[model samples]
Target: MKNRKPLVIGNLTARIPVIQGGMGVGISLSSLAGSVAACGGVGVISTAQIGWREADFCKNPLEANFRAMKKEILKARQISEGKGILGVNIMVATQHYKEYVKEAVKNGVDLIISGAGLPVDLPGLVQGSKTKIAPIISSLKSAKVLCKMWDRKYQTAPDLVVIEGPKAGGHLGFSREELETIDELGYDEVIRSVVKLVREYADKYKKKIPVAVAGGIFKSEDLDHALELGADGVQLGTRFVTTKECDASMEYKQSYLDARQEDVCIVQSPVGMPGRAIQNEFVQRVQREKLPIRRCHHCIVTCSPKEIPYCITDALVNAVEGNTKEGLLFCGANVWRCDRIETVAEIMEEFQ
Candidate 1:
């Protein structure tokens, strides 16, 4: 009913309640994030291996990422021209997660949305800064647990809460078995439960904790459905991939455009998680046989160089750089629906 309402997280506000889901390894960076922010939506930069393009990335990954993170944030601010909200998505499973959070806070990022694990210490990390914090949750159980933990530990509540359903792209919160029977799982009910749970905490903490739903949200009806389900906003990743300002190479966007329903499948990530992605030569190869890890970028905390099937960072970089055959193409369940490349403004207009 209130689909046109702004998404307000503490003092930060976006003109539209649409938060562009952050994609990794160069997918959502300065260009994409800035463009989305400029269009009045909350634009998020994925800090996963964000420094891949830096000259000393391989030699010094963390330093490279830190340097690149600041640069990207600054560039995104310039592109946004003071419109909308700019946030960064940092996975709790990432190595040196605290450092990434500190760097983003140091740069005065408007918000930090974290997931892949419960970010219990997030509030403590941004204690003195004006940077708002939110956690990505899929179920009411996780929502209650995180809210309780953050409240007990730091006496603070999240500024925003994002519910990432099974249909989302990249590494998911649901298990492989759960994802297999996702349609039968009735995720909308879970969304409602989380919204109610967050409202309870919002009352206790005396602040608004807006809930946003992610996954399979592509059309106007989808946005309406989320708002009707009591969500304050929607976070979308797949639809943005085909946008003109997306940071990924043209070939990467083409993969989404060329995708058929059957072309999308779930794969096991080397980080010991199940992920949704486009089925390709590389995906098939990884499923059947183990690909040797040439070098470790020290990206994920759970990834073992000797045991993992493939280097996730390397695969993602390949895809983002246009080497589709050898790259991993992460996508959403509705990736097949993306038929054309549009501008960020055009995409934002649809939600408006």
Candidate 2:
């Protein structure tokens, strides 16, 4: 692989094109994100039900979540010596979703990477803020939709686009049948297609929309291949979990260390989305029981807590709080490769 420096993504140049994948429900908070940014990569904090631990989280949702967002951003800024461009990953499906995006902007986030749903109106939410917006896309069609929506409505194109393949961690865009299809979609093919689409969109706008790819990327060869395919950068999430700077509990980290390739499976989430996760006892039980999940009228508007089988917020919080045995263990396909915990610097060195 050629030794090329990482490319920047937003209006302001990033020293490295690496974007820290946002993990949520307490994982990938300020400490981890700040460390990644300080090391010259784009650090990202996951805002998925982020304030589950606040004392008043149940009573005053906005106040608690807002406070957490501010605190975490402030903490990351301090750790980055005020130079790291801190970004937040906010799922468009969340309840009070717009509020979270607005709060992140109010707290001076450098960028917002939204996923889980098509954020057709995200550009409007970040109107005057310098916070760049990058929507996660699973296919070229999704990319086209997002670009068209943003251009027509907001008169602006996305600063960047993240092409997340099926092999990625957490939630996925494909269905169980699609994921289990006889012919699997090749990353190389997907990358080429998406890159071509992004380039075309960029040409029309007369601006470069930095293209980044994510999911199942773990080795130097993967990075090199992505760069060669026209992707300006890469986003990685699971690999960082094993890093020492990750804020997840030791047990949460250990789960990754102990995982085997077969342990990772695409389980059904109560939100009606398919997700990648370690097949632990919790997953087995959910599958076996087909639990009548009722969406707890708490987070994310699209979810009908009453009809959902489990509470996503509670499950993630349990894992973050160290109850991994009974909690949902979301992971990327390469999670099995983790064997030891190292610092962010050490992890980044491996890529270099």
Candidate 3:
């Protein structure tokens, strides 16, 4: 087959079909997103607790998030030198989702890739803005739901669609039982189904909606697999972690370089979702004990302070700060595949 081409999403096209998946709690910020965008890929910055570095982050996390969101996107645009697409990843499960969308649109982000929950009202939020909107779905049912809902309620279709399978990192969309039967569910089959839906909806709305598959896509062959399954592109998370421009600390990057196959596993997120991550000391301890929540940052509305396993915010902050043993090392299912640190340009060459 011929080589895969650039991904066309709405009015923006990425020379590289790879979209650098957004990582949170300090990962995949200005440095990582900007470098990836400069390499002709769609670079995504995660707005999940992005303001942890601000001076009054703990006291006013939401305010810090709003301030940092604009700053990070502006920085990414500058780094790309206006050559590549810069996008933001906002979670539907995040508190004040509309505000986050407003911040990105106000800053003129080229795209907004939202996940962690179905963004039904996303179209209304970006109604008058030029920011292209995309939703991250893990199943064909969710894809149909979003497409049908957006069409009927907002008279618009998604600019792009991201099919994030169970193998992706962070908050997953599948249930624990479904995650176990993912292989039986046949990932290729699911991707093809979503691809079909994207094409169908795109035709119905008289627009083009590109489909991208995420999770366990670490190598060129993996991209080929998704494309062959009818996906126009792929989104990767773990591979970008070891990149030199990654915003994660050296110790954090080292953990990726040093990870073994057995070290990567499916851990339960405090948000009540199953996520892939590196098995660390803190993860193990949290699994065995119910830790207390000191201060609720009002992250996810569904997260009950006393009911969850541990405080995800605190654990992730520890990881962001380079405290490996005490942090939650969220990573993709292909975490073990990352063996060395390379520049963003060099890593992009691997796909070429």
Ranking by lDDT: 1, 3, 2
Candidate 2 residue lDDT tens string, 227-295: 888888788999899988998999999999999999989888888798999989989887776555433
Q: Per-candidate TM vs. native?
A: 0.98, 0.95, 0.97
Better of 1 and 2 by TM-score: 1
Off by over 4 Å in 1: 1-3
User: Could you list the CA RMSD of all candidates, in the order they appear?
Assistant: 1.2, 1.9, 1.5
lDDT (CA) per prediction: 0.93, 0.83, 0.88
User: For this target, which candidate reaches the highest TM-score against the unseen true structure?
Assistant: 1
How do the residues 168-229 of candidate 1 rate in per-residue lDDT, one tens digit apiece?
99999999999988772478899988999899989998889999999888987888899999
Let me know the TM-score candidate 2 reaches against the reference structure.
Answer: 0.95
Model 1 lowest lDDT segment of ten: 179-188
Which pairs of residues collide in model 2?
94-300, 95-300, 293-308, 293-309, 294-305, 294-306, 294-308, 295-305, 295-306, 296-305
Q: Candidate 3 on 1-352: residue-level lDDT in tens?
A: 2456988887888888889999998899999999988988899999999998899988999999989988999899889987668899999999999999988899999999999889999999998888999999988899989989998998889999999988888888888788777693487898888898888888988988888889888998888888789888889989999988999999999999899989888888888888878988998898788988889987886799888888888888889789989999999888888888889998677765
Q: Per TM-score, what order, best first? A: 1, 3, 2
